[model samples]
Target: MAHQLDKSVPIPLYYQLKELILNDIKDGTLQVGDAIPVEKELSAIYGISRTTVRQAVAELVQEGWLYRVKSKGTFVKAPKIEQSFIQALGSFNDQIRDLGMTPRTEVLELEVIDVPGFVSDKLNIPLGSKVIYLHRRRFADNEPIVMVKTYLPYNKCKFVIERDFVKESLYPVLGESLETQIRKIRRYIEAVESEKYDFDYLNMEKGKAVQRFISIGFNYRDEPIEYSIARYRGDKNSFEIIITAT
Candidate 1:
């Protein structure tokens, strides 16, 4: 691979190297499965330290732009397609089905418990009220995707928490069993770093970037019914929203 460096530019050397490599990949100068240069060679060619080269490569690998084979070298990876949040209202299973992928869920924990203050407030219930806590590890094509924690009023849906959530969608259960229809939702998104619990559940590095979505769902009668907090891997996932003016 041939690269040109601008030593006079104010940009950091590692970032410059990263950009050059990314551009080559994007412009088809480097095709998928092409082996990238080794760190020492890259450093020598760029007149920078091997540490800088490694840093750049590490970032690319984490972002899914590259993959490293155990005994071989690093190779270019196919880019992931971004998901459009503006499309429609659907469950994770439904969304993945629309994309022609199989969505699976691993039930991590499901239990009825006393609602905490925050959860109670979000669900518009009194503190210490009974709520079903549903925790799941969501996957796409068997690859871990996101971790979700959902809270629902236990009194409204008595037997839902006892069912196998890994094989069912909570939305359907709520609609069929409790006769609750989610008519509207409020959501917020923010960037967060993986913490200890996330490391255990999502198999992510402790400090890696994640996308946090906090949502509250309402029923037809204008009553809050569901509160959920979900975290998705930033490197592997993205969301898009469309705005329409009145």
Candidate 2:
């Protein structure tokens, strides 16, 4: 049953209506991908003006709880997956599995290539040095979540080029293969317009927003061991950072 607007309270009518919609979603009256009633219908049901309904819906849309289709209607958007890896360093598969979601990976490209200038800078390697370039797309419960391109010094990580990344996590493999374990990571996060690789590998639309994660991994010796760029779909991913008083 739909909630009735309580005019006796001091709360704004639009906010009350928005809360009702959220309640419906929480109670399973509305599900992800379900279309919400139009402004006219909501206005009529709530005995409010269309302007009021618009305000409530617009706020929900802005907050990522809803989305508008050009000619179709408004819909309850799927809740974004929380990227726990951002909060702590761990295997992606293990982190996702802890969230009760199955994780899968697809190795797209694995080759030994001369380090690009950008990779050279990040890894602190010579420009012409060989690096093991690995490209992969990661999925959670069959939905594509991120596409990562990683570069590691060939002399230390050449064995990685032959390993099956689809069945293994890179960090663990690196720890076992190399003399040192990854102890620190420095990351820069930015929002960027989606490009061709996103379209092809991530099934993202051209010009859609993407969250780019640029990270450099250092070993116990403080030597830069890996440089990676991961692009996550903005609509499907959310990050959480925890700060504690130490």
Candidate 3:
């Protein structure tokens, strides 16, 4: 879709152009792996200057919605895996589906156990409290993307152990099956390098960068019920958040 530039808008021309391309990506007009029209073509069609087009394209590239290949041109990239902390709550499978990727989970381990002191504190539970633990490897289009370790209060969600996580997503099970509705979540993100978790479950190479997502979820009664740690392949995912003035 092409349209003449609007000079009256407060936004910069290139930023407006960026949203146009991004809309195409989101609306399926530009499917993953499809080559975007060259800058010259876009400039001629939109009646915008080439420099403006370039600026828009550059921003898209940096934001991971498009990738450029030398001598070939730019192409629509697989949508980046994003977690909108600002919006506050979404399941991993749901997030992957939002990106139009097939999400699959492989159950690695499920059991009940006691966690270390710091972990117990983070979960807001007393030491020695039994927690139901789940270790899973997640894939997008059959490529290993993240390894997750989830701990839930056994007293609250022991039924989770009997359910098949590969078929029933954990977050949904917590709400629909266990009656543990998640109302709030506190999240922390950090960068890390490949570790044992990656070697055992993820297909990431040695020294490859990873992004660690640590989250503690609370139920409707403001009781902490879950603590989860997910390590995502940094090269395969991107996390976006919006911050506003208070």
On lDDT, the leading prediction is 2
Cα lDDT tens digits for candidate 1, 82-150 = 666424557889887877889999998899999989898889899868998999999877878789999
lDDT of 3 at 172: 77
Each model's C-alpha lDDT?
Answer: 0.84, 0.89, 0.84
Q: What lDDT would candidate 2 get against the real structure?
A: 0.89
For model 1, what is the alpha-carbon lDDT of residue 74?
96
Q: What are the per-residue Cα lDDT tens digits for candidate 2 across 1-246?
A: 277999999999989999999888878899999999999999889899999999999999987889999999999988788876775779889988987899999998999999999888888888889999999999999999899999999988877777899999999999884453678888999999998988988898887899999988899888999899999999889998988999
Can you give the TM-score per candidate against the true fold? 0.72, 0.92, 0.68
**Global fold similarity of model 3 (TM-score):** 0.68
Give per-residue lDDT, candidate 1, residue 3: 73
Clash totals in order:
0, 0, 0
Q: Which candidate would rank higher by lDDT, 1 or 2? A: 2
Better of 2 and 3 by lDDT: 2
Error of 1 at 244 (Å): 2.7
